[model samples]
Target: MYKLKTKETDNSVIEFIEQVEQPKKREDAYRLLDIFAETTGFEAAMWGPSIIGFGKYHYKYDSGHEGDAPLVGFSPRKAKISLYFATGDTEREHLLEKFGKHTTGKSCVYINKVADIDEEVLKELIKQSVLFLQERYPGK
Candidate 1:
C-alpha cells in the first residue's frame, strides 16, 4: 500500500516562515498567510516540512488510494514561491489568466514574489479552490 508523505504535523508555521533564507520571500509568506487564512476561513498549518496549508479534506481515488490534504497551501521555496490549489476548476484557469507573473504546474502556481501577482486574483483563486475542493470532497 502506498502511504501519503505530506501528512499534517504539529510544526510551527511561523517558525517555518522565519527560516526562509530570502527576507522578501519570508515577508511574502506572511502576506500570503493572511490572505489565504482570511479568504478560506481556515487556520494555517504545516504540511510536511515546507508547505503551509489551510483546512482539510479527505480524498480516495479510484485506485483505492486515500489521504487527507489541505484545501489550499503555499511554500516559500528557493527558486520561487509555490501556491497549491485544487485542480479541475475552469475558474481557476480563468483567474490565472489575470494573476500576473506566475507559472503553473499540475496543481501548483509558481510566482517569484507576491508583488508580481494581483492580490485580488490570488484571493479569488483561494476562494474558488476552497469551494471546488469542498464540493468535490464534500463533508471535508
Candidate 2:
C-alpha cells in the first residue's frame, strides 16, 4: 500500500493552493475546491505535491493491486486544471458533452480555466462522478 501523506483534511493543501503562481489558476483551484467540497461533502487536501484532492476511498482489486486513494481531486497545472473523477474512463463520458471546453485523461478532466467551463454542469458532473464511484466501490 502507498503511504498516505496527509489526512482527509489537511492544511498543507490549503497553503499549497494559496501559493500557486498564477492568480487565475489559484482562483480556479479555489472554485474547484469549493464545488468539490460541497458536492462530495468532504474537505480538500493536498494529495501530493500539487493535487488538491477531495474525499477518499480505499480499494483492492482482484488482481492484487490495492491502496487508498482520493475519491476525486484536481490539480492546477501550468496550462490547465485537471479534475480527477476516478471513474472517468470507467463511466462518465456522458457528462463531458456539457462539460464545456476541457481535455481528459483516463481518470481526469482537464480544463484551461473555470470560466471556460459551465460551473453548474461541472457541479452536476462531480456529483454524478461521486455517485458512480460509490456504486462501483461502495465499501472502499
Candidate 3:
C-alpha cells in the first residue's frame, strides 16, 4: 500500500505560518490564509508540515488508490508559494491566463508572493477547485 505523506493533521495553522523564516513570505502566507478561508467558506487546517488546506474530499482512483485531500491549499516554501488546485481542470488553465506572475507545475501554481498575483482570480480558482472536486468525488 502506498502512503500519502500530506495527510491532514491537528497541527495549528497559525503556528506554522509564524514559523516561516522570511517575514515577507510569512505575511503572504497570512494573506493567502484569509483568501482561501473566505473563498472556500471552510476553516484552514494543517496538511503535513507545511500545507495549509481548506475543505476536503475523499478520492479513490481506478487503481484502488484512495485518500482524502484538501479541495484547495497552499504552502509557503523557501523558493516560492505553492498553490494547489484541481488537476485536469480546463477552467483552471483559463483562469490562470489572467492570474498574473505565476508558474504552474503538474498540480501547483508557484508564486513569489501574494502581490504577484490577482486575489480575485485566486478566489475564483479556489471556488472552481472545490466545485470540481465535489463533483468528481461526489458524496465522498
- lDDT for every model? 0.95, 0.78, 0.94
TM-score of every candidate relative to the true structure: 0.98, 0.86, 0.98
Segments in model 2 whose C-alpha atoms lie over 4 Å from true places: 1-11, 88-91
Ranking by lDDT: 1, 3, 2
Q: After superposition, how far is residue 74 of candidate 3 from its true place, in Å?
A: 0.3
Across 1-140, the per-residue lDDT of candidate 3 in tens digits comes to 89989899999999999999999999999999999998889999999999999989999999999999999999999999999999988999999999999998989999999998999999999999999999999985
Higher TM-score: candidate 2 or 3? 3
Question: What is the C-alpha lDDT profile of model 1 across 19-56, one tens digit per residue?
Answer: 99999999999999999999988899999999999999
- Tens-place lDDT per residue, model 2, 1-140, is 55546445455877888788999889888888888998888877777677777777777788776666788888898877888885634346777887789887766788899999988888877787777777767885
lDDT of 2 at 33: 84
List clash counts for every candidate, in order.
0, 0, 0
Q: Assess the local accuracy of residue 20 in candidate 2 as a C-alpha lDDT between 0 and 100.
A: 85
